[model samples]
Target: MSREIVAGVDGSPESLAAADWAAREARRRRLPLRLVHAWRWEPLEIPLEQDRPSQERTADDVLRKAESTIAERHPGLPLTAEVLQDTPVAALLSTEERAEMLVIGSRGYGAVAGFLLGSYGQQIIAGAHRPVVAVRSRDGAGGGDPEGGVVVVGQLGSADDGAPALGFAFETAAARGASVRAVRAWSLPPLYAYSPTSSALARADEAGGLVPYEEQALREALAPWRERFPEVRVTEHVEIGSAGQVLLGSSGDARLLVVGRRARRGVIGSRIGSVAHAALHLAPCPVVVVPHE
Candidate 1:
């Protein structure tokens, strides 16, 4: 795959907003930027006479407009523009095969209904081969923190479950000179179960009354990444709550939030997983859903 960034643009305010973010990210990574617009025929437009050619021209025009906007804002950035004849999701998925990361637009809804993540957006995120970022129209900068730059990632399941997401968060933080906030959520053991009787148990108490077992697990999870990115400041947040709620709560003013998804799709509907489901709908900042086996 090419080490470049790809963004979908169709002249919508949301698409342009995503393009702006993609351009800025391109500048950050010193990688080239590609803007793609996909067009398909519509049944009822201009008497059906100016059908195919008119649609093609419109697609080209949209591409040009988005290209010009990116150029004006990010001068001297290597840019490429293309118009695809496939549907939005198919075209973007095809383009993403050659890109390091794919950036797309979202309606930016938190508590609102189904409009923000329509079938198309969900399909694109689910079908992508690489990391996908859904950036909302407003506040294209994602977010910023005054005390320190933060990138939060949710750690769930087995030791390997969150490996991909934590690696992504650390890589991003290192690139931006930001710190990473690694959060792991837990719940109280079922009351029927007996607590460990001795300190020699599997998860012995470390110190500091903070859920010793969970705290140890969190530290073990972050150990390798911490060694890999020694310069990146790290924060380990262990809490008792839902994973989605914990991630959203810890991600305030963060530049990005990272979540993981299994590679398999469900029998029906989007298979981006639970944490990602909550994140795409409610995250105040951009969310990157990384797929891992």
Candidate 2:
């Protein structure tokens, strides 16, 4: 069996949280943890010789520090380190090729800064062949809080895309003695009341019929999984707004924001799902992307 949890470390607080989370996950799964830190040296335009030796030494120092930190915290973790000159995204994707799952800090030290996830995390998830877990900071009582917490999956009301991921989410949540939150993002388009189909839609909306129909669809979709994990706490929310925004907003205090991969087919190898993609970019906590499998 393949046994390793891979994560990128760059000495950031969020990445440190990711390291801790990955360590705990590996311990729970009885797998090894591979901690990788990638760095690049960009030569100045003035001349190739200027600051060359110093630059190389600095890169070496950074890599050594990263390796030592992991070794100290997780001794004998079967760890390995890589100092690559390739872009961060490329290095991470390459490292994840053989990993069972790639775990990354949701947010990183980016050019723009703030809570937004760095481009490296997004790109790695978009191209990873294995499962990717985007970890968030230990905000509030979410991290290392307990074994039984909650794993929330954002639902888009479209079973074709959202339904399949519930199985994986439930399995993960159940493994940790956790509950599942199946949420949906709903909205009435501006043309809802003025469209050519408006009359038919209105007729169906009598007694808030349309709302219930949508709710029932989500509930039924989640029923099978709920039945299997009867002990798991289950809750549903139908919020009005952008699917990505709603999911990202609701998961501020969640243990993990579980989502499905959504990307335009044909052009991309592994595309992050619409909601998952957006949430990974702004989630206040970790985000797990459950592929079609």
Candidate 3:
């Protein structure tokens, strides 16, 4: 029942890149790494003649290669691998139930190549109960700056609402000896756009009043976190714009981008907010979606 970091791999370069990132993260957290591959034979009508073995062999080979790669890069790191006989999304979601976090590649081959967020990745992110990180391939697309990079987290709610994300960001940054940049985005109320008096008041608020208040709120939200993680250097960023746009802009130089996902419960099904959605699809660095109550 001990918690460990789980990563999904399918023998693709992108998946391997994710594994690499996951391995480093595991090392940072001082936890074991588990690499999982979900596989199922195709053409069910063809009969199980050697096809099953071929599929099994492919999955084994992929797992072994990933294990070897992680060992080479991170010596003495605790590592394990598994081949699950189920669909990718189902397998990963099941893994999430017992994992501290689930890491996966941003894109894979075939129809998912060009898309920033592959269909399977999107599904897993939307459904995972735990934090999910999407890592880009190392060749040219995924991974963070080789040099140390900052940890950027998006904050849009009260301290209670954003506490989990802020804590995660601070922990991640502290582990990496990196700085934490907490960004808060705000705008005028809807009524301000229609009423002249409201508009003027909003303009006046923006001119000198709103920014300090926003910045103060962000500082207050992070105050306890800063105290808890005194080793971590923190920066408060307040901007006037869409939450998604502001987070995306800050992600370019970030080692990891953390965002909060409000937990939803109902028959209508759960949904990731627009800002988290944008981060998943457009972030240049790895994006971690942390579900908050």
Candidate 4:
């Protein structure tokens, strides 16, 4: 089967927004767009009147509406819509394995009313084997210049660890004819603010120059990507602060914010890292979490 960009639609405005975003993305990548809606029926607890048929019909309606929305936005886009008979998280997780990327609505806290990220969205982001993008509703709440068309990616530690995310950012920028801003967040060693000697040492280190080293590291990290995407305009931003904060701030002007999630094994629960968590919850634009080693 051919890989496609999948969007999870649940009949919410946010989900519709995600479907639209997914359609645009699929077109950008020249891939097919798949709309999935998962629904499960309640057993004896509910009346027979509101049982399997009702639930199935609701799921079908949602999928049909989403398909119509996509069709209206993308007339010639190759699209498929299906109603899956499983829990929302389960269906999305299963689809993620075969999808190029999974796009879902952010129903979490923020300016948007139904934008609160729910437990299921969090679960899928934490566990998905492929890249997952959380798109907020198409209100000014997400706070991005739709015309800006800039892709921002956060790089923590070595570029090797964030290569996948960076590559995604570059590819997105290249497709959109936009620019990529690669941000690397760093901090001073501990004890620099505790003692006078430590402060002096820090000043000496600064005099000998730590900023230059950080900048050099950022440049080195992006060197290969710059060569590979020669058509892409790249900007390296080395900042002193939390990675999440920097990325969130950058999202104001970004079309999409890309971050990396380290894949963990044998973990009991959600493995989403602190940065990815923060970005998903507070990013001003659509956030894409790319799973990496």
lDDT by residue (1-293, candidate 2, tens digit) is 57588877776766766776777676656678877777666666774466757866776776667667666766766766666777778887787656867877765332123246567776787777666887656531124535767778876645766765687678767767788888887777566475656764664465376667567768878888888878788888877788887787677567767887754455545557667767666665567776653
Structural RMSD, model 1: 3.7
Clashing pairs in 4: 107-115, 107-116, 107-117, 108-115, 108-116, 108-117, 109-116
Ranking by lDDT: 3, 1, 4, 2
User: How high is each candidate's TM-score?
Assistant: 0.87, 0.73, 0.86, 0.87
Please write out the lDDT profile of model 1 over residues 1-293, one tens digit for every residue: 45889999978888888898888777777889999999877667455455678778888999999999889878999999999888999999887657878999888654333127667888888887688988887746332222337899888866688898889888888877889999999876555544576443334445544377777778888999999999999989999999888988888767788998887767785587788998888887778999887
Model 3: per-residue Cα lDDT at residue 83: 87
Per-residue lDDT tens digits of candidate 4, residues 1-293?
A: 77899999999888888888888878878999999999876576644465568767878998998899789868999999998888999998888756999999876555333236788888898888889989877632222224336899988777698789988888888877889998888777675465656754465467576677677767877888899999988888878888888777667777788999988755586578889888877776788999898
Question: Clashes in model 3: which pairs?
Answer: 136-142
The TM-score that candidate 3 achieves is 0.86
| Residue-level error in angstroms, candidate 4, position 191 | 4.1
Worst 10 residues of 4 by lDDT: 139-148
**Which structure is stronger by TM-score: 2 or 4?**
4
